[model samples]
Target: MRLICPNCGAQYEVPEDVIPQDGRDVQCSNCGDTWFQPSTQMMAEEAEARAATPPPATEAGSVDAAHTREDALQEPPQDAWPSAPEPEPAAAEEHWHEDPDAPAPGTPPAAPPEPEADPAPAKRRLDPEISRVLREEAMREEALRSGRDSLETQPELGLEDLPEDEAARRARQSEERVARMQGLDPAPQAHAAPLDRDRLDPQPGSRRGLLPNIEDVATNAPGETKPATPPPADAPAPPARKRGFSRGFLLVILLMALAILVYSNAAMIAESLPQADPYLSSYVAWVDQWRLWLDAQAQALAAE
Candidate 1:
């Protein structure tokens, strides 16, 4: 079956059953992002899994599946993701700093100052009035759902469990009145369109990948999974080696040189700052002043 990687738009495939069976983790071959998405069938299976389980089990399973699936689907592509439309610089790209990976000069990597850590989780918003309404609505909907569902299952329910006829009639009237004011219930849910994201990645020696953006780091994997985080801007980097002369080294050298120059200058200044004898000061001053005076006197005498 052909699958399109969401990242690179590359196409690839795997045996149909292996998809959910191997676990729904799919990634693009062109890039190395891994994400999970329940195929329509997988979703149905999930729903069935939910219905068949006990209430507590169903809740837990739903939460786990939801979390896993959410984490799984956000795969990055196989090839270079066109740099995130490079955020419009707060300043220009020139000031943006550069890296070897930079498309051109400017937009370089900021010096190895640590890249900011992963962003914190997004905050949830809750408004008091709105939250109150939502809570009430949720409670009402939950009651409606529970009431509707319990009607089918609980055998112990009695006539007393139901509303009084007059109250029921009044409630129906109020509901109808409110329904008329609001819109009608939404139409039945429609089938969602099928989406398949899978692609090719190049193996170390081979020209092809099992998938584009993701590959099985487990060579057995159709390919690797997408990175949990996007690869650092400096990723796909060559192996690490001992630092020879990084900026730190240059900075150390500069500091040493500055220290030497400062020390030398300080020594000279220190020697001068102490008061000198008047004779020495005068003698030095006379060398310059006396020579000029004598030359002037000779010139005047000669003129006379």
Candidate 2:
């Protein structure tokens, strides 16, 4: 094969070993111009191949051309085509089948036309009064959107003066109220109509579901209790326990022997009784009562 550099008009012979007869690239060493070359030998081979293979319209017959070349190179199946036809050489044109995803080489893209500059938003032709009104409107909107537009100082706590227990109780109440509002348990039942205050407040002395009052639960006079001016709110509540009672049962067992002293000793005598006597009956009755007590205890446990 041969190549001619158009710029330098120098011709270079292509290495036959590298230049396959099929369409391939050949570069002019002088000008570095690259062009495609297709030889006559390749065309003849292609024609002979076409004669051996099935029609290209069939799915199996339309395999890659590169694979056909591989078969010729590796084994060159005798019954298969000996050669293939080459296409006309293609010139190194300025344009190619460009991938849509790529930008063209060396051409500045249209500058997107600068969006026509928008004329600087007309320079805001407002008088001072209008400008002030717009500024105030914007500020008002911002404040409304962000309720915490201004910073707030936290409530100051005094180590010596602040009432710790009261503060913690209030905090707990606030958190629970927030949780209730956000649909957490124990959720306040929504009413079809506004509920009366009486429904929400507990009756005096009723401890059904209400937690014990802190002052009452302290169970000791504030003055008498010198642990701290206020007990640590985070401290465990004094182990609230009620005295419990346990009961045990015992059976009265008695054994007796009688002797008749002849004369008036013929009255009456109780002999040996069977194992299943009144003693067994009494034991069974005691067990039944104990079982009833256990059942009551179980019910109490479940309620707790």
In terms of lDDT, the best-performing candidate is: 1
Candidate 2 per-residue C-alpha lDDT over 201-286 given as tens digits, one digit per residue, 9 for 90 to 100? 24444433334345553443334356547777898877856534321111111111221121122222112345435554565567
Query: Cα lDDT of model 2 overall?
Result: 0.56
Per-residue lDDT of model 1, residues 193-232, tens digit only: 1111132112334323222222222343333435577668
Candidate with the greatest TM-score versus the true structure: 1
Model 2 Cα shift for residue 24 (angstroms): 1.2
TM-score of each: 0.14, 0.13
Q: What is the lDDT of residue 136 in candidate 1?
A: 99
